[model samples]
Target: MTDTLTDRPRGRQVDPAEFAYADELAFLAAYDEGPRPPGWQLTPRAVVTFIAGSGGTAVELPTKARRKGLPSRLVIGQKFVGDRAVVERCVVTLAGERGLLLVGEPGTAKSMLSELLSAAVCGTSRLVVQGTAGTTEDQLRYGWNYALLLAHGPSPEALVPSPILAAMRNGAVARVEEITRCLPEVQDALVSILSDRSIAVPELSGTTDATVHAVPGFALIATANLRDRGVSEMSAALKRRFNFETVGPIPDLAAEIALVRRQATSALARSSSTFAVDDAVLEVLVTAFRDLRAGRSVEGWDVDRPSTVMSTAEAVAVAVSLGLAATYFPGDRDVLSLVPGHLLGVVRKDDPADGAKLLGYWDGAVRRRAEDGARLWRQLWELRDALTD
Candidate 1:
């Protein structure tokens, strides 16, 4: 029950899930007076509600807890848009103190889901080890403080704890981001940390500090992009330790469009500006993105899928860009006209040859839609030069 908000921060460009949803967390904690795993701040059900939202319902707080200064009723806002069952499974895994691995394509919000779960379960998501090729065992375990080590000589005081080590001690969640990006050996450092729930310090043998035992609620959450499958294939032993969940792209086109609108508007609001991109313009933008990503148009026309991942996250970025252009330039050109160039940019990221694919898409799908007399598609069809090299 660490009040992570004890020291509220100010002027952060992007607030972590813990800080952003501090109120909702507090409400859920008090609202659910059920039994929770030791060291957890909220129950399993509360954690799900905190992530997926309360289905637009306002939960009423118990009178006993209400006197403690919580709201009588509050509507839980949905943070991550996905299956509630997926979130529920993640919560159950963490409740059992098992390592949870969120596997998904790039920009699928795997990291965001990890952060929210960690924040709700342990009251803080600050303990994290960003896995990369350069990440060393010392970063996941413990390293010696050079200055202290020189004076103390293998003493506990000289042992600098890594974020994972700190989490083990505090019984909080330790997040490993892009775990597959780390070398196989570096990644294997976690096997013992998860299985044995302890790290052995050979140098500090014959002392209590020699072995660090994980506290009651310690667990790990690792996120791997599906695209990084070969970068560092997780060892069978390591993979056995985690419950895997695959997060895919938004399934519904309308849901995807609404998500793009919401995220883009929030991003623009950070700068004290409105999302000036029109809804129809957003629809067109999202429609094109969906068609390109799926390799099939809404009307069943075949499209040449680009090598680049046309993720929902990228769509939000493009929407934000459109909003920014409209707000800053003030009608320098139709925002709709900028769609082709922006799409070309997204589709060209992985393969330069994807430019030809985009041009082919315009020649085929854009032409057909324009021929069918859709004004937006006709305008887009006229701007085919934007996709040319």
Candidate 2:
């Protein structure tokens, strides 16, 4: 069944990507005349189209039996902004039922890509295990309800299946976020599941419920931060099970600016406020992010790169802050003046030395731009004390 915008309750804070794009997903599912892998909702080509968009081309729906209220043609909206090749490779990897691992710097949207893929392929992205240092084998495998376990003694009724196990049983995609954060042993729990396509329930070894087998379409998508690679490294055995893909920050300046503006404006709208941020202000925000993140101006002038990550996701956040400030405060402070302080907060996240790096950015890049007659940069340079104070 297709879900319409009106079908969803209003005043909700957030919606899953799958539900948000249900109509598009339904349209693609009907229009896709290609062969799909077993248990998948859409073909690999259609999944790619869903994530990267249909390039504004009209995808014709099935004429054999048109569902009421469904569109006869669809223009798939581009939800993800990155290399098309990267997404293609990810889709192919999942189709082969291999574990797909996305390793990248923070805020590169690795988790977002995983969610989109899972949603498109399986019709749900809820089967997830967030890996942390405290995550245990039980989270990746199964646990027991003490009350039920005491009474039932290792029966299936007493067992609580993990997301991984649930995905395996249902023939769906399962996600493990920050996989490297888990202890090596906890991470190793996946090695057996991926290799054997089944998990043994040792507690029920002598019973009929001793093993749970994965179905045909079952796959795993795991994400790890490149910045935390060595925090708790994955064992070679575990690494051999998955195809690794790296998701980088958005490359084009115009694309980055558009993304920041769109997301920030959406954030403001969610708060029941108008998006009053100007295009010029957004350009400054994106340009500053690009320059700081790359450690050089678009013209290639050298500057000190901060130890902390300066990703497009952070740029969107700062823009959102400025939008909200403009919405509520309304001239209590200048929008341009807030840039330096917001940037200071982003830069000084991990290392105190990052503050010096940001200051150097203001002194070098901002100063040069201001000298070149850029009004926004001049205003930002004037507020350099915001970082220091």
Clashes, model 1: 0
Per-model TM-score versus the true fold: 0.95, 0.95
Q: Which ten residues in a row have the lowest lDDT in candidate 2?
A: 1-10
Query: In candidate 1, what are the lDDT values of residues 237-315, reduced to their tens digit?
Result: 9999999998888888787888899999989988888999888889999888889989999999999999998988999
List model 2 lDDT by residue over 1-389, tens digit each: 23475675555566787998999988888888689998899999999999999887888887973789788888997888999999999999999999999999999889989999999999999999999999999999999999998886788999999999999999999999999999999999999999999999988998888999999999999999998999899999999999999999898999888878878877787878877988998999889888888888987888898888999889989998999899889989888888888888998898877899889988898899999999888898888888888
lDDT of the candidates, in the order given:
0.91, 0.91
lDDT of 2 at 94: 97
Model 2 per-residue lDDT at 321? 91
Which regions of candidate 2 deviate over 4 angstroms? 1-11
